[model samples]
Target chain A: MKTRKKVKQITADGFKYAFLTIMLVFAAFPLIQVVINSFKTDADVKTMPIGLPEKWVFNNYRDAWEIGGYARAYFNSFLVGGCTIVIVLTVVGLGAYALSKLHFKMRGFFTAYFFVAISLPGFLYIVPDYFFMNKIGILDTRMSLVIVYTAMQIPFNMLLLRTFLGGIPRELEEAAKIDGCNELNSLLKITVPIAKPIFLTVALLVFVNVWNEYLWSNTFIITDELKTVATRFVKFTGEYSSNMARIYTASVISILPVVLLYFIFSNKFIEGMTSGSVKG
Target chain B: MNNNLGQTALFAIMRNKKVINNMKKTSIIPYLFILPAFIIHFCIVTLPSLSTLAMSLFEWNGIGNATFIGFGNFTEIFTEDNVVKIAIINNLKWLAIFITVPIIMGFIVAIIVSRIIKGQMFFRVVYFIPYVISAAVAGKIFTAYMNPYYGINVFLDKIGLTSLGDTLWLGNPKIALYSVAFVDNWHWWGFVMVLFLGALQQVDPVLYEAARVDGANRIRELLHVSIPGIKPTIAFVLIMTVMWSFLTFDYVYVMTNGGPANSTEILATWIYKNAFAKYRAGYANALCVLQSGICLVFYFVQRYISKKGGMEDED
Candidate 1:
C-alpha cells in the first residue's frame, strides 16, 4: 500500500510540474517573441515570426531611435514624469502626514475628502479637465502634463503615504522633538528617513504611472514635439499601417526604461503595493 | 544683588516665550507640507471634474457658445443609444474576464512561484516585466505577432493547423474583442502574480509544515493550506480586478481602437470616441456619468460582500 501511494504521489508531482511549465510558457511566450523580433530586418520580420532573424539587423534600432525621435520624446517623458513625481510626492506626503499625524480641526473632513476622490474613475474628468487646462493657457506644454498627472495621482498617493506613515510609531517624532528638532525638522529628518522604503515605493509607483500615462497626454497635448512617449504610440502608429519592424522596434525601445526600473525596484514596488492592497 | 535677581527673572520669561513659539511652529509644519498637494488636487482633479458634471447639463461644441440642455444628454444615453448598450455588454465581458482569469491564474502562478525551491526571483521578475511596458508598446507587439499572413498565423499553418492562422483575429468583429482581452490578460497577469506572491508570503509556513507532517501530498497541501491562507487576498483581488476592468481604456484603445465595426468597444474607449472623435461631448459626458454609476455599483457590491464575509468569519 505504501509503495503504491508513493508511486501515485510521484506521478502527481510530475504532472504538476508539467502543468506549471505549460502555464509559464503561456504567460511569457508573446513577450519573448516580441523581444526576438526586435532584432529582425523588414523582410525577416514579415517572413520569420517565430524563428530567429536571417541576418541580425541592428539598423532597425538606429532607424527606430532616429526616425521616432525617441531621445527627445524620452527627455520630454522624463521631464514631465520627474516633475510630476516630485510635485506629487511632496504634496501627498505632507497632506497624508497632516491627516495621519496632526490633530487639526478639519482632519476628519479632509481625510474623507481624499478617500472619496480616490474612488472616482479618472476618465470622468477628461473633457472638463482639457477645457480647464486650455483656459489656463498651459494646454500644449510639458507643465500641463505634469500638473494634470500630479493632480490625478495625489489622492491615491496621499492615502498610501498616510497608511505607511500611520505604521510608524509616534515615539520617533516625539524623540526628535525632545532633541531640538521642530515639527518641520522632525518630519524632514526623522519621518522621511525612516520611511525611506515607502518613499522609494511611492516614487517608483509615481514614476511608472506617469511614464505609462496615455489618455491625458493624448488629450491635452496636441503639439507634435510636446508628445510624451506614451502619446507617441497613437501619433506614430495611429492608423495601424506603420512598417512592422520599425514600429515593433520603436515600441520595444520606448518601454525599455519602465521594464528596467521594474527589474531594479520590484521588491519594494511589490511590498508597498501589497501593503495598501492587503489592508484594503 | 537686586539687579542680578531681576536679570534671571527676565531670562526665564524669554525662554518660556521661545518654547511656546516653537510649539506653535511645529503645529503648522504638516499643513505647510500638504499645501502643495491640496492646491494641485483642487486645481486639476476637483475643479475640472466638477466642471465635467456641470458640462453634462449643457449642449455646446467645445468651440461654441454654451447652451443649457439639462438632462438631455442623460436622457439620450439611456433611451436611444444602441452603442451605449453594446458598450455596457462589452464592459460586462471585461468585468467577467478581469474578475476570473487574473485571480485564478494569479493564484495558480503564485502557488507555483512559492513552491519553487530555486529561481523564484527569476520567475517573478520575468513574469512581471511585461506589466511595466506601456499598453501602447504591448499593443504594437501583439499587432505584429497576431498578424494573419506573416505572423503567428503562418507559423500555425506550417505546423498543419492552418485554420488558426487564416482567421482574422482582429479583423473579425466577433472575435476581435476577445483578441483584445487576450492581449490585456498577457499584460495584466504579472501584476496580479506579484500581488498574490506578496499575499503568499503572509501565509504562515507552519500550516504547510503541519500538512506535510500529516502525510498530505503537494496538491492536498496546496488545497488545504494555501487557498485558505490567502482568501482575503483573493477577495481583495476580485474587487480590484472588477474595478480595473470597468476602467480599462488603454489596452482596448491602443490595441483595437474599438475597431472592425466597434466590436471591441468598452465604456472608456466608447466615451473617448463619442466625446472627442465624433464631437458629441455632451453625450459622452452622459456616458461618463453612466460609467461612474457602473463603477459605484461594483464598488458597493464588493464592500457589501467583504463586510458580510467578515461577519461570517467572526461567527
Candidate 2:
C-alpha cells in the first residue's frame, strides 16, 4: 500500500511537470516563431514557417530599418516616453506625497476623484482631447503625446506611490524636521531616498505604457516624422503588406527595446504590473 | 521692572507672529506641490471628459460652427446606426470570452505552477514575455502567422487539419473578431496567470495540508481550497476584464481594422472610424459616452456584489 501511494505521488508530480511544460511552450512558441522568421528570407518563410532559416539573411533588418523609417520612430518614442516618465514622476510624486502625508481638507475629495478618473475609459475623452489639441495647434507633435500620456498615467501612479508612502513610518520625516529640515527638505532627504523602489516601479510602468501607447499617438500625431514606434509599425506593415520578412523584421525591431528592457528588469516589470491588482 | 516686562511681552508677540507666518507658509506648500499634477490632469483628462458630454449633444464637423440638437446623436445611435449595434454586440461577445477563457486558463496554470518547486521562475518569466511586447507587434506577428500562404495555415494544412488551414482567419467575417481576441488572449492570459500565482502564494498551505489529511485528491483540493483561497483576486480580475473588454482596440485595429465589412467592429474601433475616418465626431462622442456608461454599470455591480459578500462574512 505504501509503495502504491508513493507511485501515485510520483505520477502526480509527473503530471504537474507535464502540464507546466506544455503551458510554457504555448506561451513562448509564437514569440519564438516570430524571432525565427524574422531572420529568414520571404521565400524561406513562405516555404518553412516553423523552422530556422536555411541561411540567415541579415538584410531584412537593414531593409526594415531603412524603408520603415524605424530610426525616427524610435527616437520619437524615446522622446515621448522619456519626457512622459520625467513629467509623471515629478508631478505624481508631489501629488502622491501630498495625498499620503499632508493634512489637507480636500485630500479625500482628490483621492476619490483620482479613483474615478482612473476607472473612466480613455476613449470617453479622446475625441474632445483631439479637438483640444488641434485647437491649441500642438497636434501632430511629440509634446502633445507627452502631455496626454502624463495626464493619463498620473491617477494610477499617484495612487500606487501614495500607498507606498503610507507604508513608511512618519517618524523619519518628523526626525528630519527636528534636524532643521523644512517640509521640502524632509521630503527630499528622508522620503525620496527610502521610496526608491516604488519610484522605480512607477517609472518603469509609465515608460512601458507610454512606449506601447498606440491610439492617442496615432490620432494626435499624424505627421510621419513625429509618429511613435507603435503607430509607425502599424503603417509600416500596411505599406509593406506583401513582404512578410520585412514586416516580421520590423515588428521584431519595434519590440526589441521594450522586450529587452522587460527581460532585464523582469522582476520589477512583474512587480509594477501586478502591484495594483494584487494589492487590491 | 515694568520696562523689562514690556520688553519680554513684545518679544513674545514677535515670536507668535513668526509662528503664524510659518503655519501659513507650510499650509500653502502642499497646494503648490500638488498643483502641477492637478492642473495637468484637469486640463487633459477632466476638462476634456466633461466636454465630451457637451460635444455629444452638438452636431459639428470638427471645424465648422457647432449646433446643439439635444439627444440627437444618441437618438441616431439607437435608431439609425447599424455599426453601433454591431459594436455593442461584439463588445459583449468580447466580454464573455475574456471573462471565461483567460480567467480559467490563468487559474489552472497558476494553480499548477504554484505546486512546482523547480524552474518556477523560468516558466513565469517566459510566460510573461509576450505580455511585455506592444500590442502592435503582437498584432503584426499574428497577422503574418495567420496568412493563408506562409503562416501556421500551411502547417495546419500539412497536418490534415484542412478546414482551419483553409479558413481565412481574419478575412472571414465570422471569425475575424474571435481571431483578434485569440491573439490578444495569447499576450494577455499569461499576465493573468502571473497575477493569480501571486495571489495563490498568499493562500494558506496549511489548509492544503489539512485537505490532504482528509484524503482530498488534487482536483478536490483545488476545487475546495484553492478556488476559495483566490476568490477575491478572481473577483478583481473579473471586474477589470469587463472594463478592458469595452476599451479593447489595439489588436483589432492593427489586425483587421474592424474589417470584413465591419464584422469585427468593437465600440472603440467603431468610435475611431466614425470620429476620424467618417468625420462624424458628434455621433462618436455619443458612442464613447455609451461605452463609459456600460463600464460604470459593471463597476457598480462589482462593488455591490463585493459589499454583499463582505457583509455575509461578518454574519
Candidate 3:
C-alpha cells in the first residue's frame, strides 16, 4: 500500500510540474520571439520565424532608430509622463490628504465629486475634451496630455492615498502638534516620510499608465515630432511597413525601457495596486 | 470698565458666529485639501463630460457650429446603423469572455504559483510584464506574430498544420472577434493573477496545515481553503473585468481597426469612430450615455451582491 501511494504521488507531482513548465513557456514565448525577430534581417524573419538567425545583425536597430525617429519620440514620452506624474502627485496628494485627514463641512461634496469622476467613462468626454483643448489653444501639445492624464489619475490615486492616510494613527498628528508643528509641517516632516513606499508606488503606477497610453496620445499629440512612443510606434509600423526590419527594431526599442522598469518595480506596483483596492 | 470690556468681548464673539457655527469645522479642512483634485477633475473630466452631453443635442461637424438636433442622433444610431448593432453584439461577447476566462486562468495560475516556493516573484513579474506594454505595441507584435507569412501562422503551416493557419485570423469576419479576445486574454490574465496572488498571501496558513493533518490532500485543500480565501477578490476582479471589457477600445482599434466586415467592432471603438471619424458627435454621445448607463447598472448590481455576500460571511 505504501509503495503504491508513493508511486501515485510522484506521478502527480511530475504531471503538475510539466503543466506549469508548459504554461510558462507559452507565456514567455512571444517576448522571446519578438526579441529574437527584432535582431534578424527582414528576409531571415520571413524565412525562419521561430528559430535563430544565421548571423546576428545589428543594422536593423540603426535603420529603425533613424527612420522611426524613436529618440525624439522617447523624449516626448518622458516629457509627457514626467510632467504628468509631478503635477498629479502634487495635486492628488494634497487633495487626498485633505479629503482623508481634514474635518470640513463640504467633505461629503468633494467625496461625491471623486466618485462621479471615477464613474464617468473616458469615451463620454473624449469628443468634448478635444474641443475644449482646442479652445484652450493647447490641443496637440504635451501639456494637454499631461493635464488630461493628471485629471483622470487624480481621483484614483487620491482614493488610494486617502486609504493609506486613514490607516496611519491620528495620535502621530496630535504628538506633532504638541511639538509645535503646524498641519503642513506635520504632513511634510512626518506623514510624507512614512508614506514614501505608497507614494513611490503611486508615482510609478501613474508614470507607467501615462507612458503606455495610446488613445489620448493619438488624439491629442498630432505633431509628428511631439508624438510619444506609444502613438509613434503605430504610425512607424504603418509608414515603414515596406521596411519591416525597421518596424521590428522600433517595436523592440519601444518596449525595452518600460519592460525593464516593470520588472524592477513589479513588487511594489502589485502591492500598491492590490492594497488600494482592498483598503480603499 | 469691567462692564464695557465684557460687553465688547460678547459683541466680538457674536459677530464671528457664522465661522464658529459648525462643530465639525475641523472636518472642513479635509474638503479644503480635496479641493484641488475637484478643480482639476472639473476642468479635465467633468467639464468635458457636460459639453459632450450638450453636444449630443446637436448635429455638427467639428469645424462648423453644431446644429440643434435633439434626439435625432440617438434615433439614427439605434435605427440606422448596422455597425452599431454589430458593435453591441461583439461587446456582449467580449463581456462574457472577459469575465469567464481571466478569472479562471487567474485562479488556476494563482493556485500553481502558490505551491511553488522558488522563483515565485520572478514568475509573477514575468506574467505581469505584458500588461505594462501599451495595446499599440502589443497589437503590433501580435499582428506580426499571427501574420500568415512570418508569424505563428506560418509555423503551424510548416508542420502539416496548415489547416490551423487556414483562416485569416484578424481578416476573417467569423473568427476575428475571438482572435481579438484571445490576444486580450494574453494581455490580461497576469493582472488577474496578481489580484488572486495578493488574496492568496493573506490566507491563513494554519488552515492549510490543519487540512493536511486531516489528510485532505492538495485538491481538497485547494477546494476548501484556497477558494474561500480568494472569493472576495475573485468577485471584485470579475466586476472590474466586466467594466473594462465594456470600455475596451485601444486593442480593437489597433489590431483589427474594426475590419473584415466589422467583426471586431466594440462599443468604445464604435462610439469613437462615430463621433470623431463620422462627425456625428451627438449620436456618439448618445451611445456613450447608453454605455455608461449599462455600466452603472452593473456596478451597482455587483456592489449589492458583494455587500450581501459580506453580510453572509460575517454571519
Candidate 4:
C-alpha cells in the first residue's frame, strides 16, 4: 500500500512539473520570440523567426522610433496617462471619502449607483461619447480621451478607494476632527496619508489601463501626434508593413515600458490587477 | 410679566432660525465632495447611456437631425442585420469558451501551484508575464508567430504536426475568432489563476487532510474538497466571464478586425462599425441596448443562482 502511494506521488509530481513547464513556455515563449525577432534583419526574421539573429542589427529600433513616431507616442501616452491618474485619484478620492466617511442623504443610493456603474459595458457609451465629444468639438484632442478615461474608471476606482477608506478606523479621522479640522481638511490631512497605499494601487492600475486602452482612444484620437503607443501601433504596422523587422521592433517598443514597470512592481501589479478586476 | 413672555418667545424663534441655517450648511458638504466626480461620471458615462434609449428610437446619421422613428432601429437590427446575428453567435461562443477553458485551466493550475511547496511565486509571475502585454502587441506577435510559412508553423512542421501547421490562423473565416480568442485566453487565464489561487489559499488545508484520510484519490480531492471550497469564486469567475464575453473587442479588433468576411465580429466591434463607420448612430444605440440587455439579464440570473446555491452573500 505504501509503495503504491509513493508511486502515485511521484507520478503526480512529474505531471505537475510537466504541465507547469509547458505553461511557462506557452505564456512567455512568444514574448521572448518577439524580442529575438526584433533584432534580426528581414531576411533573417523570415528565415529563422524564433531563433537568435545572425548578427544583432540594432537599427530596427532606431528606424522604428522614427517611422513609428514613437517619441510623440511616448509623450502622448505619458501626458494622457499622467492626467488620467491625477484626475481619477483626486476625484475618486474625494468621492470615496464622502461615500465611506461622510453622512449624507442617498448614501445607499450612491453606493448602488457605483455598483451598477461597475456592470455597465463600455460599449454602452463608447460610440455615443464619440458623437458627444464631436458635438463638443473635442473629438481629435487628447483631452477628450483624458475625460472619457477618467469617467469610465471612476466607479471602479470609487469602489476600491471607498473600501480602503472604510477599512481605515474612524478614530483616525475623528482625531483630525477633534483637532478643529474641517471635513476637507481632515480628508486631506489624515485620510490621505493613511490611505496612500491604496491611492498608489489605484494610480498604478489606472496608468496601465490608460497606457493599454485601445478602443475608445483609437476612435477618439484622430491626430498622429496625439496617438499613444496603443493607438499608434495599428497604424505603425500598416505603414511599415513591408519591413517586418521595424514592425517587430515597434511591437517591442510598445511592450517594454509596461514590462519594465511590471518587473519592478510585479507584486503590486498582481495585487492591483486581481483586486481591481471589479470592473472586468 | 407680559413683556418678559414676549421676549422669551422672540429668543426661541431666533434660535430656531439659526439652527435651520446651520443644518443647511453642514448637509451640503457631502454632496459638495462628490459633485465633481458625479458630474463627470454622469455626463460622460451615465448621460450618454441613458440617452441611448432615446437614440435607439430615432433615425439619425450622427451629425444630423434625429427624426423620431419609434422601434424602427430595433426592428431593423432584429430583421435586417445579418452581421449582428453573427456577432451574437460569436459573443455566445466567446462566453462558452471563457467559462469553461479559463476557469478549468485557472482552477487546475492554482491547485497544482498550491500543492507545490517550492518556487510557487516563480511559476505565477512567469505565467502572468503574457497578460501584461497589450492586446495590440500580443496580436502583432501572435500574427507573426502563427504565420503559416515562417512562424510557429515552421516549428510545428518539424514536430510532425503538418496539417495543423499549414492552416491560416487569422485568415480563415471559421477559425479566425477562435484564434483571436486563443491569444486572449493566453493573456487572460493567468490573472484568473491568480484570483483562484487567492481563493484557494483562503480554503483551509484541514478539509483536504480529512478528504485524504477518507481514502479519497486526487480526482476525488479535486471534485469533493477543492470544487466545493472554491464555489463562491467559481461563481464569481463565471459571472465575470459571461459579462466580459460580450465585452470582448480589443483582441478581435486588433487581430482580425472581424475580417475574412466578418467572421469574428462581436457586438462591441459591430457597434463600433455601425456608429463610426456606417454613421448610423441610432442603429449602434440599438445594438448597445441589445448587448446590455443580454449581460444585465445574465448578471441577474447568475446572481440569483449564486444566491440560491449559497455561493455568495447579497451585497
Candidate 5:
C-alpha cells in the first residue's frame, strides 16, 4: 500500500512537470521563433520558421530600421510617452492629493464620476474626438495623441494614485504644515517624496499604455511621419507583406523598450496593472 | 519659476488672514488642486462621451453641415446596417471565449506557478512577456507565425502535415475571429494569470492545510478551498474580461481589418468602419452609443450580482 502511494506521488509530480513544460513552450515558442527567424534570411524563414540559419545574417535589422522608418517612429513614441508621463503625473498628482487628502463639496461626486469615466469605452468618444481634433487643427500631430492619451489615463491613474496616497499617514503633511509649509508646498515637499514609489509606478504604467496605444494613434494621427511606434508597425507590416523577416524584425524593435523596461521593473508593471483589476 | 505665480500669490495672501478666513480660503484650494486634470478629462473624455447622445440624433458627414434627424440613426442601425448584428454576435462570442478560456487557463497556471518554489519568478515573467507586447506587434508576430507560406505552416509541412500546414489561418471566414482571438489571448492570458497569481498568493495557507487535514486531494482542494479563496478576484476578472471583450479592436484591426467578408468584425471595428471608412460619423456615434449601452448594462448586472453575493468589493 505504501509503495502504491509512493507510485501515485511520482505520477502526480510527473504530470505537473509535463503540464508546466507544455505551458512554457506555448508561452515562449512563438516569441522564440520570431527572435530566431529575425536573424535568418527570408528564404530560410520560408523553409524553416523554427530552425536556426545555416549562416546567421544580421542584415534584417538594418534593412528593417531604414525601410520601416523606425528612428522617427521611436522618436515620436518617446515624445508622446514623455509628454503623457509629465502631464499625467503633475495633473493627476494634484487631483489625487485633493481627492484623498482634502475636504471638498463634490469629493464623493468626483470620485464616482472618475469611476464611471474609467468604464467609458474609447470608441464611444473617439469618433467625435476625431472631428474635434480636426476642428482644432491638431490632426496628424503627435500632440493630438498626447492630449487624448493623458485624458484616457487620468481617471484610472487618478484613482490608483488616490488609493496609494490613502495609505500614507496624514500626520506627515500635518507636521509639515505646523512647521510653516503651505498646502501646495506640503504636498510637493512632504507627501510627494514619501509617495515617490507609487508615482513612479504610475508613470511606468502610463508610459506603457501610451506606447501600446493603437486606436487613438491610428485614427487621429493620419500622416506616416507622425505615427507612433505601434501604428507605424501596422503600416510597416502591411508594406512589408512579402518579407516576413523584415516584418518580424520591425516588431522586435518596437517591443524592445517595453520588454526591457519590464525585465527591469516587472514588479512595478505587475503591481500597477493588477491593482486596477483587483480593486475594480 | 518653480511654482505658478497665481498659486503663490493666493497662498501668500491667505497666510496673513484670520482663522475664519483661513477656512474659507482652504475650501476652494481643493478645487484649485483638481482643476487641471479635471479640465483636460472633461474636454477630452467627458464632453465627447456626453456629446455622443446629441451626435447620434443627427445626419451629417464629417465635413458637411449637420442635419438633425431624431431617432433616425438609431433605427437605421437595426434596420439598415447588416454588419451591426454580426458585430454584436461576434462581440458576444468574444465575451464567451475570454471569460471561459483565459480565466480557466490563467487559474490553472497560477495554481502551478504558485506551487513551485524554485524558478517561480521565471515562469511568471515568461508568461507575462506576451502581455507586455503591444497588440500591433503581437498581431504581426502571429501574422508571420500563422502565415501559410513562411510561418508555423512551414514547421507543420516539415513534419508531414500538408493539409494543416497549408491552411490560411486568418483568411478563412469560419476561423478568422477565433484566430484573431487566439492572438489576443496569446497576449491576454498572461495578464489574467498574473492577476490570478496575485490573488492566489493572498489566499490563506491555513485553508489549504485544513483541506489537507480533511483528506482532500489536490484537485478537490483546488475546487473547494483554492477556488473559493479567490472568488472575488475571479469575479473581478470576469467583469474586466467582459469590459475588454466589448472594447477589443487592436488585434482585428491590425491583422485583418475585419476582412474576408467581415467575419471577424466586432462592434468596435464596425463602429470604426462607419465613422472613418464610410464617413458616417453621426451614424457611428449612434453605434457607439449602442455598444456602450450594452457595456453599461453588463456593468450594472455584474454590480448587482456582486451585491447579491455579498462579495466584499470595497472599491
Candidate 6:
C-alpha cells in the first residue's frame, strides 16, 4: 500500500511539472520570439521566423536607433515619465498622508471623489481635454502628457499610498508633533523616511504607466521630437512594415527599459500592483 | 464678587478664541496637503468631463462655432451610427470573453501553483512578464506572429492544419476582435493568477486540512474549500473585468485600428475615430457618456450582487 501511494504521488508530481512547464512556455514564447526576431536579418526572419538566425545581424538595432528615432523617443519617454513621477509622488504623497492621518471634514468626500475619479473612463474627456490643451498651447509638448498622466494616475497612487500610510504607527507622527515639528516638516522628515517602500512602489507604478501610455501620448503629442516610445512605435512600424528585423528591433528597443526594470524589480512591481486589488 | 465674575468671563472668552484659532490651523493643514492633487484632478479630469457632457448637447466641430441641438447626438448615435452599434456589440463580446477566459485560466493556474512546493515564484514572475510589457509592444509581437506568410500560420500549415493556417487573423473582420482580445488576455490572465494566488495564500489552511480529512479529492477540495475562500477576490476580478472591457482601447486600436470594416470597433476606439478622425465631436461625446453609463451600470450591478452574496454568506 505504501509503495502504491508513492507511485501515485510520483505521477502527480510529474503531471504538476508538465502543466507548469507548458504554462511557462506559453507565457515566455512570444517574448522569446520578439528577442529572437530582433537579432535576425530580414531574409532570415522571412525564411525561418521561429528559428535561430543563420547570420545574426546587429545593424537592426543601429537602424532602429537612428532611422526609427528611438533614441529621441526614449529620451522623451524618460523626460515625460520622470516629470510625471515627481509631480505624482508629491501630490499623492501629501494627499495620502492627510487622508490617512489628518482629521478633516472633507476627508470622506475626497476619498469617494477619488474612487469615482479612478473609474471614470478617459475617453469621456479626451476630446474636450484635447481642445483644452490646444487652447492652452500645451499640445504637441511633453508637458501636456505629463499633466494628463499625473492627474490620471493620482487616484490609484493616492489610495495605495494611503493604505501604506495607514499601516504606519500613529505615534511616529504624534511624537514629531510633540517635538514641535510642523505638519509639513513632520511628513517630509518623519513620514517620508518610513514610507520609502511605498513611495518606491508608487513611483515605479507611475513610471510604468507614463512610459507605456499610448492613447493620450499619441493624441496629444503629435511632434516627432515629443513622441514617446509607444506612439513612436506606431509610426516606426508603419515606416518599417516590410523590414521585419528593423520593426522587431524597434519593438525590442521600445520595450527594453520597461522590461529590464520589471525584471530587476519584479517583486516590487507585483507587490505594488496586487496590493491595491487584493487589499482594497 | 462682581469683579471676580467679570475676570472669569474674560478668561473664558480668551480660551474660546484660542480654541477656535487652533481648530482653524488644524483644519487648514489637511486642506493644504490635499489641494495639489485636487487642483490637478479638477483641471484635467473633472472640468473636461463636465465639458464633455455639455458638448454632447451641441452640434459643433471642435474648432468652429457651436449650436445647441438638444439630444440630437444621442438620437443620431442610437439610430444612425452603425459603427456605434458594432462597437457596443464588440464591447459586449469582449466583456463576455474576459469574464470567463481570464478568470478561469487565472484561477486554475493559481490553484496549481499554490499546491506546488517549490519554484512558485518563478512561475509567477514568468507569467506576469507579458503584463508588464506595453500593450503596443504586445500588439506588435502578436501582429508579427499572426503575419500570414512568416508566422504561426506557416507552422500550422506544416502540421497539416490547413484551415487554421489559412486564417487572416487580424485582416479578416469576422475574427479580428477575438484575435486582439486573445492577445490582451495573454497579457492579462497572469496578473489575475498572481492576484488569486495572493488571495489564496490568505485562505485558512485548516479548511483544506478538514476537507482532506473528510476524504475529499483534489477536485472536491477545490470546489468546496478553495472556491468559497476566494469568492470575494473572484467577484472583484469579475467586476474589474467588466469595467475594463468597456475601456479596452489599446490592443484593438493598436492591432486593427477598428479596421477591416469596423468589425473590431470597441466603444473607446469608436469614440476616438468619431472625435478625432471624423470630427464628430458632439456625437463622440455622446458615445463617451454612453460608455461611462454602461460602466456605471456594471459598477452598481456588481455592488448589488456582492452585497447579496455577502448576505448569503452570512446565512
Q: What would the TM-score be for candidate 3 when compared with the true structure?
A: 0.90
Question: In model 5, what lDDT does residue A69 have?
Answer: 91
Q: What are the RMSD figures for all models against the true structure?
A: 5.8, 5.5, 6.2, 6.3, 6.2, 5.3
lDDT of 3 by residue, B199-313 (tens): 8989999999999999997789988888888777777786776676678887788888888777888888888888778877677888887787777777777777877766125
Fnat, model by model in order, equals 0.65, 0.74, 0.67, 0.68, 0.79, 0.72
At residue B180, candidate 6 shows an lDDT of 93
DockQ score for model 6, please? 0.63
Candidate 5 per-residue lDDT, tens place, A82-155, comes to 99999999999999999998877899988888888887788878988899899979989888999999999999
The TM-score of candidate 3's chain A against the true chain A comes to 0.93
**Candidate 3 lDDT by residue in tens digits, A155-274:** 778888888888887668657855877667778887888888888888888888887888888988889999999898999888877655566778889888878887788787777656
Q: What's the ranking of the predictions by lDDT, best on top?
A: 6, 5, 2, 4, 3, 1
Clashing pairs in 2: none
Per-residue lDDT tens digits of candidate 6, residues A1-280? 9999999998998899899899899899888888888899998887767768898888888988999888888899999999999999999999999999887899999998888787777888899999888887888988889899999998888999998899999768767866888889989999999999889988998898888888899999888988999999988887778888888888889889988999999999999887655211
Distance from true position, residue B129, model 3, in Å?
Answer: 1.4
A156-246 in candidate 1: lDDT tens per residue? 7788889889989876886687697777788889889988878788888888888888888888788878889878755676543447778
Alpha carbon lDDT of each predicted model: 0.78, 0.86, 0.79, 0.86, 0.87, 0.87
Cα lDDT over the full model 6 = 0.87
- The regions of model 4 sitting more than 4 angstroms off are A1-11, A276-280, B1-25, B157-160, B213-215, B304-310, B313-315
Model 6 bad stretches (over 4 Å): A277-280, B1-24, B306-315
Better of 4 and 5 by TM-score: 5
TM-score of 6: 0.94
Q: Write the per-residue lDDT of candidate 1 for residues B18-92, one digit (tens) a residue.
A: 656654766666567667777778777777677778788888666567789999988888888777788889989
Q: What is each model's TM-score for chain A?
A: 0.93, 0.96, 0.93, 0.95, 0.95, 0.97
Among the numbered candidates, top TM-score falls to: 6
Give lDDT for model 3: 0.79
